[model samples]
Target: MDPVTSGILVVIVLLVLMAIGTPIAFALGAVSLGALVLDQGMGELTFFGETFFGHVSSFGFVAIPMFILMGAAVASSPTGRDLYRSLDIWMGRLPGGLAISNIAACSIFAALSGSSPATSAAIGKLGIPEMRKRGYPDGVAAGCIAAGGTLGILIPPSVTMIVYGISTETSIGRLFIAGALPGLMLAGLFMVWTLLACKLAGGYNSPNPVAQAAAQIKENVEGNVKALIRVLPFLLVVLGILFALYGGVATPSEAAGVGAFLCLALAIVVYRMWQTKPIANIMRDALRESVMIMLIIATAEIFAFALSSLFITQTVAGAIADMEVNRWVLMGVINIFLLVAGFFLPPVAVIVMAAPILLPIIVAADFDPYWFAVILTINLEIGLITPPVGLNLFIIKGIAPDIALRDILVGSLPYALCMILGIVLLCFFPEIALWLPDLIMGTGS
Candidate 1:
């Protein structure tokens, strides 16, 4: 069979496996291996062990667990709660203030922890009940967290970027820097949508008219100052990491290590919950989370290797490049395909499976790969809020079980549209993603 035909069959089989509830890692590795064995017999199987082990054996990949540890450690502490409370007191006066604050907290937490589910769970646990208590609509409250959570990977120090970089041999550092402006841009878009949604929906519901009036009046006097003081340390740590990485003072791994240690130390000192057992438990959670991700990554390596050896990836890219369609139209079509695929797979799986096939086509069309990364990341962001496999939707459901999954999904639609707008913005102004990396790292692609 032609490589294109074989590649198409492999994808169909992989999707069937996923639809039938196979784990992504397993489906990916299984389909790849099946193709290999069919093409060249069991002797070709020896490549699997080396590829799987070697892919995970990178110093660059070290940043993934380190960043996850940092996030888990912070989540185990009071930082998330404190950050929310701080933003809440200040942002809580706006239309849908609590919801706005939820997005703000998620963005900040995204900076602190580069994992979407962690961002959602940590902020959702704090934001949801409070919003519900404030009479914010359940769907609105849940949706905001669900949407905001997607920022975790678009922000710097992102684990998704790490995996993409490792897979594509893109400079991880530049990818990290490239994400900053776009991440902030998406966060801004979410906030705008929240404000507009709440306004149209009759705004935030206050618990007590008299108390709210009194609190707002007091907030006029001293709240901002107090909130600033309360949040400064946490903000400083997040800023310090960004400054280190963006300033070229540290590699991503070193930066992650520093951020993890610093955040852990801050968590202990400020929360003052440095008991032996609690600390041990915090580390244990981080280890558990890290191990789970590492396993998926290890198996994904097998899939990546099989795709490369079979030339399926390059063949698909070449075919797409050879198409007579306008390049921008092709980009749009490719994005649509990604959006559909994202409904069934997690962000990591989408990137691992598609980047190899689509990236070269993107480059061939003269789209900046760095800029394309931002656009692709936005697609992944939408995936996090999308249904069936929308990781953030399920995350919010897990955190706020009473909020129906349908409500969360419905609420996320606007924000998902906002993310689509962000993608359009990147498509028009690739410089939004390129400028920061070029300024900081001096451009290479």
Candidate 2:
């Protein structure tokens, strides 16, 4: 088969496998194998071996598993729970306040983890039931958790940025810095819209039922604060490492390792949440998840590697470059297309499949990568709330299986609109993304 035809066939097979519910890793590997065989006969099987090994072999990839471990550790231990309860008390007075606070919590966790599904799975365990028991609307309850989960991509330490940096040969450190302002802006948008929506809905926030007692609210607040105080050491440990990395005192890989160890010690020794059984369980779970994510990453590498080799990516890039529309018009079209694509693709998968194509066009037009990354990240965030294959939505549903899918789906729309608004606001005033990167990289925009 001609290479172009083979690449096109590979794309078709991948979409079919994805549509038919093949796991993403297997779908990528399978499509790659099919393409290789058609193009180079059975001898090309060796290339699959090479590709698989090459994908997992990067030293930088170790950061992914470590970050995953740290996220899981915080979730299982008391630190994350304490943080949630504290935020809950502070925000529980307003309509949908607890829900909005949950969004805030996910945004905080997002800075550390950079994986949306992790943010949902972790925050849902603490946030969902608490909000429901407090009489929060079911759909509003579930929507907050799902929408908040998207923070993991927009925030600093984002795995999406790492992947983007790696793919584009940009500096990952700069990408991390680039994401800071935009992540917070998106989170702020979620909160503002959520506040308005709750007021308009009139049935959203759980009354300060406990808080009306004054004494009871005070007790809860004090207890949560004390618990959070105990968790501060761990938070500090993680922060210190990232801070050093950010200030150029250490590299990201070194910081990740340090952060991982600090989390382990805190989880086991300080939090006292670790028993032998739990420790074993944590390792097992972390390993299983890490392997699944790594497999997908590797397969994506193969697909990207081969696709670029065939210049199919270039063909797609050329098409986008040829369009002479206004940049705003082009951006709007790009964002709308991405939102539609996000409905079908996993966040990382969307990034992998689309960024390469869009990026060259963006660069040729002299648009900024950092700004584009933030913009695309926001688009992917909306996808998490989108229907059908909205992965975070389903993950939250899995946590609150008792909650109607309709409820979660219904609640997500307002938040989704808020996210879209954020994209538009950022599009017009890109300073939201550019400010921090400028300050850090010394490149005044």
Candidate 3:
């Protein structure tokens, strides 16, 4: 069969399996296995074990579970509440301050957790109710949390970036640094829109009387101090890990190990979670999520191998390359494809399956792979809040069951636009994404 026919059949079978409730890992594995058997006959099954194991046996992949454990530790504790409280105390008086605080909290938590759903669930649990209490519109309240959570994949220690780096042989450190600036830019955009939205909605809260404000500040002084102290250790750990990674003090796996240990220790000491149940819950959550992601990575490797064996990878890349299209136009098409893929697949799956195929095309177009990583991430971020499989949107709904799904979707739309604007700005000023990585790591090329 022609590569095009085979590619379509593979996609159709995979999608049908997924639509009928097959797990992504299984569907990917099944399609790849079937394709290989058909293309190469039964002899291929003899080496399937080796091929599958080889895909996930990388030492760098260890960073995934360790980072996930770090996130799980932080998520299982009261750290999210403390971070929100700290930001709230400082920013809560500004117009739409509560919502802004939520976005800030999400950005910080995104750095800590490196998982969007965890960031959303942790911050949303506290921020959503608090925003609702403060007379913030439900749409604004839900929108900020949902949108802010997408920052997880764009920030350092990001599992998605790790997967992309591993898939494409890009430097993980450069990928992390590449995302730092763009992530902050996107967060700033979220905050800017939030401030404007609140103002346009006649403000989320009325101004407090001078005397009442002073009294409220005095009352919360001790608690705020305690909250800041509680939140400081986690921030320090995250910063330390980033420094280790960027400063060449440790490999990604090594930094992740130390970060995971420190985060778990802090969780135990600060939250008094020494009990078996809490500790076990953290491990269980980390293990479950880690296994899910690793399985997808392994299966995606198989899928990619199948595509290569079928000549689809080369065929498609050659077809696109032969078009001689404008680089930006090619990028626009790639972004659309990624956005659609992301609507159904998680970030890791999309990165592992698509990055290998896209990276060469992007580099052939004279684009920096690291910068494109940020762009690809922002595209996927939009999908996290989009429909059918918008994980963050569902997380918001679960957090605030009474909030209409329509309201959550409506609220998240503006933030999605903010991400698109972020992409546009990055395109016009590639330095926005490239400058940091270049400054620190000296141009990844």
Best by lDDT: 3
lDDT of 1 at 420: 90
Residue 359 lDDT (model 1): 79
lDDT of 3 by residue, 95-120 (tens): 99889989999999999999999999
Compared with the true structure, what per-residue lDDT tens digits does model 1 show for residues 156-252?
7788998888778788878888999999999999999888988888988443334657767676446545644655776687788778866778878
Query: Can you list the residue pairs that collide in candidate 1?
Result: none
**Of models 2 and 3, which has the larger lDDT?**
3
Give stretches of model 1 more than 4 Å off: 205-231, 443-445
TM-score of 2: 0.92
TM-scores of all candidate predictions against the true structure = 0.92, 0.92, 0.97
Off by over 4 Å in 2: 1-8, 203-214, 309-311
- By TM-score, who's the top model here? 3
Q: Cα-based RMSD of the predictions, in order?
A: 2.5, 2.4, 1.5
Model 3 earns a TM-score of 0.97
Clashes of 1: 0
Whole-model Cα lDDT per candidate? Answer: 0.82, 0.77, 0.92
